[model samples]
Target: MTQGLDIEQMLAQHIARLKASLQQASGEGSGPEEGSDAWLLLNAFVENDPQNWHTLLANFEQSGHWLAEQGGKLDVRIVALQRYIDALVAELKQILSEQPLLLVETVERLHLLQSESIQALTRGYQSVTDQCLRDKDMFSQQLEHRLLALQRINGVSNSAMDLDQTLEITAQAIAEELQVDLCSIFFYDDMQRVLTLRATNGPRPLGGMHFTQRIGEGYSGWVAEKGQSLLVHDVMASPNFASEVQAYSSDYHGLMSLPIIFFGDAERLIGVISVLSQEPRDFTREEISFVEIVAGIIAINVENGRLYEQTDEQLRRKVHELATIHRVSSVIASTLNLDEVLQMITTQAVHLSGAERSCIFELDPDRRRLHVLAHYGLNANLVGQLYINVGQCCAGRTVQTGRPSMAVDCFHTDEHCFIRSDPFISSEIHSVLCVPLKVKDKILGCLCVYSSHRHLLSAEQMQLVNLFANESAIAIENARLYEETRRGLELKSVLLRELHHRVKNNLANVAGILSLQRRRSKSSDVRHILAESVNRVQGLAATHDLLAHEDVSEARVDEVARKIVGVASTNLVPPEKHITFKVEPCGIVIPSRAVTILALIINEMVSNAIKHGLAGQSVGRVIVRGREEDGWVYVQVSDNGTGPAFNLQFGENSESSSEGLGLSLIKNLAGDLEGQFSLRREHDLTSQNGTNTTGDGPAEYTVAEVRFPLVRRSRTRE
Candidate 1:
């Protein structure tokens, strides 16, 4: 419309400058059109009549108000419009140079037009701002409607380990969240082809455990059958809704059902979740999607809850089984009494096998018959009398086949376990389960437990019985082995005692023969040699006699010392010698092999003390003390007599001399004791433990001490 100026270009510039947020807030489909904002500004100049200029500005106000609100300054659009007007004026001035008055009027009108357009833009600015503010409030409300999905999931996950509780909690939470009148969870049984209402937020339409419908029979069932969601505004209007199926299901007007699908399982449907409203209601896409999400969460958590329950139950069962086995193992290890242990085994097997009465049978020596070794709840008179041939009855078959066997309805069925029907019928024995009591490859016997009622055992229960059966077999074998070993030990002890007695008698005869030779001798040297030899032989006899008396391979060191001293007093001491002997024991016990050597050592020491140390002394005292310390055994023999006339080192021996021969024997005996021997004269000899002692040693006492390693022996048992 003007020279050197494109009106549409100037309008396009201002349109590009419009606020993007304002366009976005109004939505892409809404906002200024091709002939709005800058287009309205150009309309004021495009209209020919000056009277309609304000009216055109009013039109601009209708479309350009949002632009006016966006750019409050209006500097860019105003400058563009002014430049177009200046370019138009220059062209006009050139044309109207010959008419000064008209040109002046045109300039004044252009200035007035600019002022009116600015005023129009200002009015539209304030009005559109108020409208945008109200629109902002409305848009914000829509954005806040999406629920916190994490909060919802956490609310349902609190009781997810418990399946029933999870269902109920999910139903209630979803109902409250969606603001529905009722929310119900229905579990679909593929085998039964039915949908069962397992949990509900409100009162159930039917009695609990009775609310069920075949798949595709009702609105909820249809969703499960299709594995798709269903949203019905009116439950009665639903084509799949069958009122006849359940009269109370139609109480709700609106219903929305979603298939709870296990996503991990290729979208397999697990159940159906339904929310019902008492009044007709419309569901938005957002609401439907949220409900779908809740259904999916329910599907996943339900699976987890079932798995958790199964695992927990298995763990509890394992703990119980282990505890029971431990108790049985303890009892087997605790006693060797065959009857007592068998009774305990039968009791445990009866309880474990889920039966009332139990019996343990043993294979007879002939291996053709099974006899009741121990039993619970059976006739006491029938224990040994009740016998069954191999491969005949339950217990017998178990032994014959070396496996577990069960006889069901034993009394009524063709296979009968009881020999006398009267006792079996009276006891109500209808079923019996028998398993072989075998250890390794050896079958000891069989264990039979019967129930009063017809009973069937599970595989897990049978395995438990098998475990107890193995333990019982071990017990039986252990008891038998222990009995055999005990009898063997008794026989060996008797033989040993007799051998010891015979040995003692033989030695006594030898000593008597030596005494006869000594009396028949005409030489004092021969009598002394004979006397020492007799005392040595008598000491050995005394030691063996003590072993035979105690019936053990070991004897107390003090007892051996006392016996040796008694022998020495009788053989070496004269009645007028008035020598006193005292024995003190520190409760030290040495093996029989060591005791023999110990006896010899004591005999030599005492003989030496009587013959040489206490020589020519009318009154003297001989003390034998046993002591133990730091893994060593000590035997100190002291006497208040004359000390050795000639010094004899323990390591050196002069066997040609009588006293030296005795010292040599003692040295060799100490070597056999795995010990050392020392002889000394002490001024004071007080017994360490005060077993038997005087105030002090009034004179010098000859002390002989022999020590060996101490060893503590433990009895062998299980």
Candidate 2:
């Protein structure tokens, strides 16, 4: 068996040398004509293996089984070798059929050669199997190392480290795993179509490295553009590689650039991961595939980190917005002062929005112009001087459109017409955001913020400013309403005081005229009637005086009653008659219009008590009381005198009644007050014992009481 294996090895070597010599001669164009001498040589070798071809095929199948047992990488190589052996056996059978019959001695040598060829094939299979096992072991170690690196990368990614630190960690892990001189991550900016070198791990320090390349420009950019991986063994020979992009003072011999494609869609390229070697070395297929998987993991980590940053930034912005709104709302709710509210709005807007200046312009009533109402971070001279006409500038355009207006890079454009003017021209404003102060379809004005840098306000930032503007608009409207209400109240108060003064003076003049007429009257009855009329007018005039002094829309019923009783008792009761007046403390307030009628009712009742009840008597006592209960007011006037002989019913127009016209007038006044009026006689035992009495019984008293629904004015006191 050993000798046969040696012979098979020697025959395999001879065949290989013959094939090489034929191929070399063919290349030099000095070989035999096509399919002539080369065909004969190959046919002779196959004739030596004619009889044992079936045995060789069986042995090849057994070897295939053994190769299949090795599994994994050896399976494909085993199948390909078996196909080649089967094809060679068919060709030998065809060649031997053309040779017809050979000698029996030649047939014996053919069988021996066939056995040696099968042994040689078996030896070759064993050699390939041994190499596969060694490769498999090496692959296992490489896979284990890659897994450890990936685990470390995952650990860094899962940690709370920020995006930059995580990227640095990923770069270091890739460099260590691949054993490369330099590993760099280039982040692609889709908007700019440029790849910026973000993180690097190499011999050279990573400071002052600002390498960038446009898409399809350099090795990394080309990989990104093609959305594929590239392995260049020699950087100098590669057309896409640029030496300037390499790390400083480090020799770069080879480059491997892999696209950081999003996992689900391989076409969406986000960036590139590049590994460089100091020596010219060809990358193995396994190494290339390993780097591709690492690139995918890195891509996932990068995407996760980007999303985390965006979410975290959004959360921070939302928190800041809520805090700003709370602060501004607190300031707005604290006061109704318009100027103070406007000032707080502008100051807080500028501070929160990171603006160099902010101003609020109020639209005039005509809506044709904007006037600067409040401002912060602007020169005092520029505030009032900066005005915008409607449909002319940023502030005006915002009002015209009833939407927010923005002008980024304002200095280079004519978009902001307002800033083109004198005061704003010197302000050096580059960006401006103007939001209309709108409330329920009413555009009150515009709120504007100016920045010195272009594109300073993002869309989210603009939305935040708009929210603030909405709150400011509400605060401004509230302040204006408050101011208008205050002014209206002041005007009403002044008008009310003037009206009361005029009415009091007019009533007094009428009472004075009546008094003069009473003095000039010839008949005694005429003088007496005029005097009574003058006293009634004077009572009403006294009520107006009380109202004028109080400076209110309603007068205290008790105060007005006391004043009326004093004037009536002093004027009607003669000096010869001893009449004492008693008024109870009353705490009820009634409308000013009702005061005149109330005074008249008190005057008639008191005068009637003094004139008729105490006509013949020299002494009398009158009592006046007023109070409120259950939404109703009661005023009672009573006198202890020679009581009337008849009962007085309210609403009775009887002229012959002992109370006469006073009772009729009292009944009419009660009807005007929407009240119930009654006059009755009562017996007072205490009065009878203390003073004058009628006959041997207690003195009779006349009491007049009126009960009315209390119509309270807005301004009232208990």
Candidate 3:
């Protein structure tokens, strides 16, 4: 017995050391802080027979269960327990070192305990996880039920506005669809925990169609209290679930009650729904599901009706918002002048956003800085002078991120819109709202609004501002494009005028060179050829001269015809012959390409009439007439001198007459004009295959006429 007492003392000391080690590892003080979970766990192992291994293990069964219930890191606590076991085994080995057999047995028992403890820990962890999965499935089931309820409500659209009318309709529909003798709808007041009958179908209840009672008083109230469905196939014979049969009547015997629950953060007992039969009936799983779905639908519809009644002010505010945005779009679209449109946008920004001041900054070409294009409520001087670098000020930050931003007590206090320093345009300007102006993916600029007082700007107002900003960005882009196009057109006009002047000068220089060569030549044939070349060159110069003076693209045909006639009279008409020239250009103009060719043709025609027709005449009459007929421009040069060798029909010139280089040139030029040329006598009347007969009559007058299809045209006046 003395030896036994000594062994018990040794065991107690060993147990005490084990407990102390566990407590230290678990970060607990040694002064019996038994309130902690680790200490409680230690006590579970300690409050057992110290010498009897089986008894101690029996008390500490499922060590992992204890740890799991303690509710801390399972792996960490298991590690601590492992360390304690190691230490306890070493101490026990030292305490029983003299008894080799006992020492081996004690070590075996400790090893067995560790193994059992590890297995128990695994099992307990799995058990906790299984319980969590079960809870998740239960939540999913509740969610599915609520969704089915919502679907049922969706099917029952066109509900009445009045809650009483809506409940009556629901009760009638459920009764007819389910073929029940009685269907009752109960409305619940969560705060009062009371159930009130609102509507019923079929026979009336003992309490009548509308009655109120505490939540747990009757069958419907009992469903409200329990928050569960209760089905009584035989209401009178059922045990203890309900205080009394609901709607007690001879017409109905079977009863089924369901809680009208709103499954939100927590299940809320909204009301109850009941269905009854004339005979005893058992509710099937599918039938109960259907009824529960209908009950959920009733709960949602009632709640939504209440919500609908409370949102009149919100709907009114929404209408006002639509009008405001409409006003903004109209105001922004009113102008295409970039500067004026910016001004309008800034002004509208101030009005729509309720801000004290607003400004719009345009992103510069290099994308380094923003130049203020327009401003409102702020100093007008800042409009063109203010500049902010990208990522510098509130607007700059918006540009950097290409997003909408707002700051209360901005510039410094607010981190999102803060800059390195403040411009301090106004002491009243405490809040800022900045939004980026985006067109597709390109960031054109940013718009910034300032308020004098510090106040939180609602997201709705910010969104309103953003909407305007997008429209304003498009307006600005369109205006900028217009400005660019206008400038481009002006520049192009200047360039075209310059080109015509240069061409005129070049043609005049060529004419001057030809005139000099004519003076240097001794041969009369070369001189005559050079003189005609000078006249032709000068004719083209005349047309360009007219085009250069006017901003018009083509030259007046009358002007061109008169210029060529003057050149021909000055250089081609014989000195001895008293010659007269007249040009009648009946109000017409030709485009530049056609004008050049027409000038050369007229020069050749007049030269031919002078050199061949009026070769020996002492006094002569020459006339040039232009007219439009049958979609053709006709220029006729007439003279009393002899006609050319060619007749009205090409290659039909009488062999008796001579065909010179002048007449041949005229024929080729007419072809270039896509036209026809004719040499005919004034007295020749009859036409034979468009040719005149070689009569003894040398015609009294000669007429050289050319006709071309009129393709190009310009202003009739120069």
Candidate 4:
């Protein structure tokens, strides 16, 4: 019995030390206090038997009631003590029944042990209350730190312009705020299905390191692929931590990878933010929540920066395009030559479009082929040999459809492939921009720009090229018209010079024939008739002389009429008659054929008026007037002198009452013109006030008028 009692004492002491050690580890208290209910219950159980069990159990119940009253509720430490007391009572009852002698000797010590058990219970409850207060304070501090880090992250995200810089700043902030060893940001490349390490701040001393991982292959990639957050306490033990991450950095023991999901219905996963710790750590709920919030902020800022870059680039391109258009417009406006204009267009296209070479293809309508008219930055031989059938290649297709076409990365793409198989050139061209040169609905040709490097032209660049193509078409058409006009003018000038030469030679022959006739005649009347005929021929020759000096395609009727009237007046009008010859200004121009006929008609009329009407007068006035009105040309020759009162002749077959050669010639010439001839008496010329009369007492005057349809050989002249 004595040995058994000693064993129980040793066991009770070991149990008390174990409880105290557990309480200290749990941050409760070092041990139960003296005189507490927990200390009393422990001592009574260690020393008492079944006779004292009932009393000890009663004392334990009373101590639990007192702790509940003092501590407000049943704490974990009090509950554990109550369970221990119930087990102690059951053991003590078993000992009394099995070993009656052992309980008989320990029963007298129960009163002393009860006080120590109650003291232990009270101390355990107090330790539990203090631990609860410490935990609450720690949680509050963690929450406050998380909120401050979130504010700093938001500030960095909102003010950053550059995406890479923003990412670096975000990574550094996260690492410093969370007290992490490493913070890495991985951007997901959707096309490649990979995550590229974009930014990182860590102790590994990575310098100029580029790392990428396929989705579902590594720690960061798995988060992006799954679109979930993963908290790995022990990277080596976690099955999700891939071997690649193990190989990348063996220094990290803890990892938290969260997917950066964009805010949308699809919730697109853009990337992953990984926070790593050098020592093993179980991340708190607050830390994980903070990381997720920062990831959302980083995703939004990245997308915004990308959109800003795109918009800014578009604006810059627009400015450049406008300037290019202005320059091309200046070039188009300054020139009328076709070749020079095409050359300028090709050069500007290559420079402005960032193309390696450019060519302007002109369509041959008859051949139905596109021929290179001008080119820049290409082999001369190749350009000379380059031609494509309509609807065959890039340029040809643009012409056939009258729309723009582009081939990006032509070497790899089969659709709308560029012409790289040509034998004349071995240059590897990768992209092409072909725009049709169209005016109205007519496609003149196509302008093609090529690049040796593979790249796609933006919509703005494409639109600018199309606009330039339209301008080029207009300029080309204008040049073509100018060339045609110049050629026509040159041909017309040659014909007019030839006609004048022939007319001069023919008039000289006629004058020679009249001179011969005049010299052979014996009678004075015959000689006078031959001389008058020679004067008519000389009048016609003088009209041709005026036309030959003026480099014009046709002669003016008024100018011819003046020359003819001057010749007639000088030869036929007597100086003693004081005849003043006047010719009114006219704005009528006729072909060379019409001028000869008009000269002969005017010559006969003026000679007849001078010789017949002013034959017996000492003073006379002969006036010739030519005018065109209402599609008819009228010429009037009048003299204020006595003349024959001849009737008007209306037809070619009508005969004259007088047998004079001048009247017969005048009638025949009028018939040749398909015109009407009339003779009438004219009153003396008078001013508006009737003060400037040519002669007194209504001087007898004869007026000869010829009228003919005004014919236009070409464009009408004013």
Top candidate on TM-score is 1
The candidate, 1 or 3, that scores higher on TM-score is 1
For residues 1-718, what per-residue lDDT tens digits would candidate 1 score against the true structure?
A: 4631333343334433332322443345544344544334334543435566867578645535767555655566566556545654665576567867656765666567767776676567767877788888865664354355435555667542567776777777777767888888888888898888888888767566568878887887788888888877887665568462245654677778888888774766688888888888877786788788787677777776666566556444543443355445435433456777778778877776677888888888899988888888777766657778898867877899998987676554444456344555445777777889876577888887778766677766676677667767777776665666577876655555554564465457556756775687655655677778778878887987998786456778878988898888888898888988988755677766676678878898898888878888998888888887898998888888888654444543323354476677677667756677888877767777543374453557888878888655553111
State every prediction's TM-score relative to the real structure. Answer: 0.45, 0.43, 0.31, 0.42
Residue by residue across 1-718, what tens digits does model 2's lDDT show? 5544443454464554444455454444544333332333343444445444545555454554465455535445444434433434443344345443332323444455445544544565666777779999998998898888878888887788876788788888888887888888888898899988878886543344577878988787788888888878888666557553454577787788889888664455678988888888788887788778777777777776666566556444543543345345434433456787788778878877888888888899988989898988876775667667898777888899999988776545555565555545545788889999976689999899998877759765676577667766767776665666577876555544443454455456556655765676554665676677778777876876787677546777778878888888778888898888877667688876577778888888888888877789898778787767798898878888767676655643434344465776678677768877777787763321255333346666787788788996665676
lDDT of 1 at 369: 89
Provide the RMSD of all predictions against the true structure, rounded to 1 decimal.
Answer: 27.5, 31.9, 32.9, 34.3
Ranking by TM-score: 1, 2, 4, 3
- As a whole number from 0 to 100, the lDDT of residue 448 in candidate 4 is 85
lDDT score at residue 264, model 1, on the 0-100 scale = 75
How far residue 168's Cα lies from its native spot in candidate 2, in Å, is 6.5
Q: Residue-wise lDDT of candidate 3 within 137-228, one digit each (tens)?
A: 98788667655544554555444446676677677767765678878888887677677788887666667755776867777767777888
Worst lDDT window (10 residues) for model 3? Answer: 685-694
Relative to the true structure, how large is the alpha-carbon lDDT of every model? 0.70, 0.69, 0.67, 0.69
Clashes of each: 0, 0, 0, 19
Q: Which pairs of residues collide in candidate 1?
A: none
Poorest lDDT segment (10 consecutive residues) of candidate 4: 106-115
Worst 10 residues of 2 by lDDT: 685-694
Model 3 spans with C-alpha error above 4 angstroms: 1-166, 173-182, 186-198, 202-226, 231-255, 261-271, 275-290, 296-334, 337-390, 400-412, 415-433, 438-444, 448-467, 478-718
Better of 3 and 4 by TM-score: 4
